[model samples]
Target: MRKIYVVGIGAGDPDHLTLQAAKAIGRTNVFFLLDKGEAKASLVELRERLIKHYGHPHKRIVEGRDPDRDRTPADYTGTVADWRHRRSLVLEELITEHLGDAEIGSILVWGDPSLYDSTIAILEEILERGAVDFEFEVVPGISSVSALAAKHRVGLNRVGQPFQITTGRRLAEGWPEGVDDVVVMLDAQHAFTKHPEADIYWGAYVSTPDELLACGPVAEVADEIVATRTEARERHGWIMDTYLLRRNR
Candidate 1:
């Protein structure tokens, strides 16, 4: 049986790579990359830089075209399921056709493998299909959620309090009942602005060189976050952001 390592390379900055992630890169014979197109070409370069910095020069890279998905669909979950099925097929083919001579292959994921990443899930699907025989190990890295709190110099919850991590779409429906502390990720719509009373600690492109940060009452800083987000997206052609919202302040 072959082995694959699913390594988390951290949020945005190259410096976010942990010693474990660096070691995993050093061990990988082939780096399985999901091509996210030119808009996110910078991410590809970042991954390469990590390999170059940590691994030997002989390591090979295998690129697979990622399946396209409806960014705004009526049935979000259904669309995503279909997309992932297609993605797993693509990934399986890559594993079978690309790594025949290699014994150790790896996927470098952004954030932790346990978070909003799907590489681990797709790998599991491949195993369940009985088309491939490989053992995989997950190496966790610092998530943007943790980086968000660090950059903001604020705690996620008050002493003995609880918090929830949710996406922007779920939050747009309404504030979740009985949850005063909320961390929102993958929010493209500036959903945090809807609640006027909440205190927000927001950051865009966290840990990256083009990082942006703002904190205040949602009403007071909403316009600033919106304007900044618009300008950043226009400039970079893409953006990945997350924020924390707290009420009863």
Candidate 2:
């Protein structure tokens, strides 16, 4: 049987690549890439750099256009589902045409596969359609959440307490019930601004050369974060950020 490795490459930092992920890259027969256009060209470059350093000498790299999606949709869940389905079809074709029997192909993910990434789900959808046959393994990498906490030198949860990881959309809706510590990702709207009373540990492009970090009571630093994030996004054309919000008990 052919094999597919969903390898997490870490959040924008070459150093974050783990030993297992390196081995997977070195063993890969093919690497599939989805181009997100020039606005995020650095991301594609990072993948290329890793493949060059650790991948097999004769590894073939294939490219596919990443399916576009609505950033702001009236029906968020439905829109995302449709987008994922489209992406699954794209990747299905890539695997069917490129991957040969008894060879290994890989999809290098930004963060851990178990996080917000859709590669795993896309693979599953392809299998469900009965169009592909391959066994896959997920190689975990450091997540931005973990990187944020580490960069800030802080723990995720309080003693004997649990922390919740949520998207900025849900955080904008409202804080989760009964959790003092909340980690937020994909927060395009700067949802942390809503909870001015809470303390925040925030980092943009964590573990990368262009990393930016800020922390303080939201009331004091919300404007600063917004300004920094906006400026950075304008300068880089994209930004990936995560933050932890701690509420005083």
Candidate 3:
């Protein structure tokens, strides 16, 4: 039987890789890196840096690109399911080509694999099909949410106050009622524009030398963040950003 390790390398910083994650990569026979195309080539480069910084001489590297899917469908769940299926197929193929007979194959994931990452879910589907005999293990790393909080020097939640983790799309639809603190991710639409009254702290490329951070009353700096994010994305060709919003009580 073979074993598979999904190791989170953390957001964009190679130093963010956990000690355990680095060990797992060093012990693996093959390393699979996901390429999200040119728009996100920086992500691929970051993984390469992690490998170069910590990988062993014997570990072989394999790269795979995720296929683009039109996610504008009405049924969000259906679209996500379809996309996962395709991703699983590609991953399985990569395993066969590079590590079919190896004792272990490892994939380096961004951030903690359990939070908002689909790699484990896709691997589960591949396992269910009985196409591969492997045991899955996850090595956690620092999450962007944690980095966001640290960069802003603020608590994600106030004393006794609950917080929610949501995406930009949902925020654009409208703020969730009754929630005072919301951490937003995958926000391509500047969803902060929707809640102009909330206080916001935003960070792009957290923990990296190129990191950009801004904070103020949401009403005061929301437009600045939007304009900054737009310009930054255009300038860098990619951006991985996260933000926290707190409604004034």
Please report the TM-score between candidate 3 and the true structure. 0.94
Candidates arranged by lDDT, highest first: 2, 1, 3
Q: For candidate 3, write residues 1-249 as lDDT tens digits.
A: 778999988877777887899888778888887788887887778787777777787778888889778757789889888998999999999987777654788888888999999998998999899876688899998999999998889999998888999999999988888779999998997888778888998999998878999999888998789899999989988788999999989
The TM-scores, one per candidate, come to 0.97, 0.98, 0.94
Pairs that collide, model 3: none
Supply the TM-score for candidate 2.
0.98
Q: What lDDT tens digits, residue by residue, belong to model 2 across residues 29-86?
A: 9999999999999999999999999987899999999989999999999999999999
How close to the true structure is residue 135 of candidate 1, measured as C-alpha lDDT?
93
Better of 1 and 3 by lDDT: 1
What CA RMSD would candidate 1 show? Answer: 1.2
TM-score of model number 1: 0.97
Ranking by TM-score: 2, 1, 3
